[model samples]
Target: MTTDRAMRDTDRMERPAPPAPEPLPRPVLDSHVHLDIVGSDGAGASPEAQVEAARAVGVDRLVQVGIDVESSRWGITVAEKNPAVVATVALHPNDGPRLADLDAALAEISAMAEHERCRGIGETGLDFFRTTGPAELAAQERSFRAHIAIAKRVGKPLVIHDRDAHADVLRVLDDEGAPETVVLHCFSGDADFAAECVRRGYVLSFAGTVTFKNAVGLREAARLTPLTQLLVETDAPFLTPTPHRGAPNASYLIPLTMRALAEVKEVPLADLCDAISATGDRVFGPWP
Candidate 1:
């Protein structure tokens, strides 16, 4: 599967910017985002500006997710200054193969994960989509288990990034014993997988991709997820929703995705908003 950042970069060259959708009746939280990447869209938007834009559109709260050491620390810094934002620090599944010292990077991530503003440890899990060898796969699994340990030790939610390696992800979690709270970021599974995750007491955080016309399977998964186990995110500047497909995305665009999710779940939009907000607080704890 193509990474969201790669899609965002190519989409930047090929599509027009998406117009913001109607604001939600009740505010909601974006459970996962990469403000560092969103801020680098060459549009010159700062992290603060992005947060402001999200708030303007009823995305009042957000989780700034980190995929590497620099982005993790940067996310913490952004969270420190922005009350609307909390952060998650971790080494992404893809990061293990690139880091010169994986252990050292994980150590820094471990230290940073303890920060008061850091509410989760992840974007870490298996990614079979990009790995080219067994060694790389082993490294990702090793890092994933270590991150599970960190999240457990810190008593924060474990946010997982499962990409084309769903079974392996579940295996690793079972092996290490999952943290009390677990979130499957950008949940990309069918109904069976969704049922499995839900059975394991994991929350599934849907992103803008759920709004895509071809995302029938994803929509099915969304329909099956209970409100208490549901969360929403942009994963910006990627996975821009329908009528704006292939365009750069941001938190301000989440109402479109939220509305799509509401339609899929056959729930009132306002109710979905309230549920997602409640789920956010439950998964990440109260934001300051």
Candidate 2:
């Protein structure tokens, strides 16, 4: 018998043995993932298979974010081919030097934003955590400013990737007249910073760090931030939530992070799901 036919037969037998109720769906929207990395092998299941795995765990949509010009183009191409995926194009803070001609890079990003499947501008911002020199920091700042300019010019939300440079990031964003909707993606700051972002009408996106045993500060921020201002992401093939920590990350791990957030906020999982999904929709524009 065909696979579908076998599943039907098994369902029929299981139904008679004991009235099996439907399984509760996993409520999640993995706001970020790196399908290009996951699909690089192009052999086995593929990144598309990863999407299927995520779907099995209740993730309905994912934003495929690009870290450089080539990755941005690949992200857009993937989104165009997959209805469940949306693309965000920008040079990551660490990739600042690669974009020597800021204007030309911005032009390319802007063009990608115009694509029907492209949803936002970023995964961009400052990363003091990784800068090697004053020159590197300056380059990162220049690239960040360029990204903000593009976000303003395109009138789309900005996805920020601040790491150990919260003050500088905030300062630059303020100086640039903050984009329409700013998201501190994978927020790892303290409650005060979260409050500051909330005060500025920026969204705070939580990642797997919230699930770490040593992440008291992140958990506090998760608890303190208003539900409407909170967002969630995988930042995967990177920050895998606990139980799966150090494993190859994917959108499928979002529930583990969400469960941690739900606990932090003292809210039911379903309610937390609704609030975060709504926040993501508001910030990114309705999923395509």
Candidate 3:
């Protein structure tokens, strides 16, 4: 994807801006976000402003993830600046080929993992949904393996992003001795897949798509999965939840997503929030 020019302007602006409203009072953790994308959206909100908005909405913490090496580094930098934001560094599947030197890339990621603010080792996995070609598939697999190896070596949870490559992803995770904590970020699979993942002790993180009126399949997956294995995410700047659909998303919208999850699970909203928040803390480690 092309870089957003608006983000560059925000980075250059010299004056400090006003603070955002405190996050909402819910016990939620936004497991995925793209702060650079959100900040670049031409909205008045800066990255810091977004965090404040999330706080105002009751989100306790957020995990900002990167899609490429540059963004991975930026994710760490942003996390370092915000007490409520933790970072995950990995080359997203779509950007897998960008890592020309796999070993060096892993080394850089390893260094980032040393930070207290860095919580996990991914946003990495297979994506057969987009490009297709023997060469591209091979490249994606290579990158995915490299990321898994890094997570194994560093002993950090593996945050997976599987899109239209569920079978292959499950196979790889099984082969790789799947990390102790495996989070399927923005899980878009069916109930069977959800059951399999839960059986394997993987966590299924739901995004705003769960709130869509026609998202029967996702809702089923959400309900079928055990609450202890469930988590919620914004995947912000993308997958904005219903009501807020078609607009830019942020961590602040996490409760709406959680409320939807509560509806699917047929539990009270407070119970759902408590379970997800506790699960997130256990998986991601303490909020920095």
**Against the correct fold, how does model 1 do in TM-score?**
0.95
Q: What is the TM-score of each candidate against the true structure?
A: 0.95, 0.87, 0.89
Task: Give the whole-model CA lDDT for all candidates, comma-separated.
Answer: 0.86, 0.76, 0.78
Q: Write the per-residue lDDT of candidate 3 for residues 156-238, one digit (tens) a residue.
A: 88999888888999988877778788999999899888989988999999999999998898899998999899999978666
| Alpha-carbon runs more than 4 Å astray in model 3 | 1-25, 39-44
Q: Give the Å error, residue 56, model 1.
A: 1.1
Rank candidates, TM-score, best first: 1, 3, 2
- Model 2 TM-score is 0.87
Worst 10 residues of 3 by lDDT: 1-10
lDDT, residue 176, candidate 2: 86
Give per-residue CA lDDT, model 2, range 1-288, as digits (tens).
001111222222222111111222445688877776642221113667767767777787888887778889988888878777888998888777545686687678878876767788888898876578988888889889988988888788898988889999999998988988888889989989988999998988888888999999999888889998888887765666776565556676677888888889998888888888787777765766
**Angstrom error at residue 209, model 1:** 1.3
RMSD of each: 1.9, 9.7, 4.7
1 against 3, candidate with superior lDDT: 1
List model 1 lDDT by residue over 1-288, tens digit each: 126443346646345556667888999998888777764442226888787778878989989999889889999999999899999999888878777999999999999989999999988898898789989998998999999999999999999998899999998899889899999999999999999999999999998889888889999999999899999988887777777777777888889989999999998999999999999998886988
- lDDT (Cα) of model 3: 0.78
Candidate 1 clash figure, as a count: 0
The best candidate by TM-score is 1
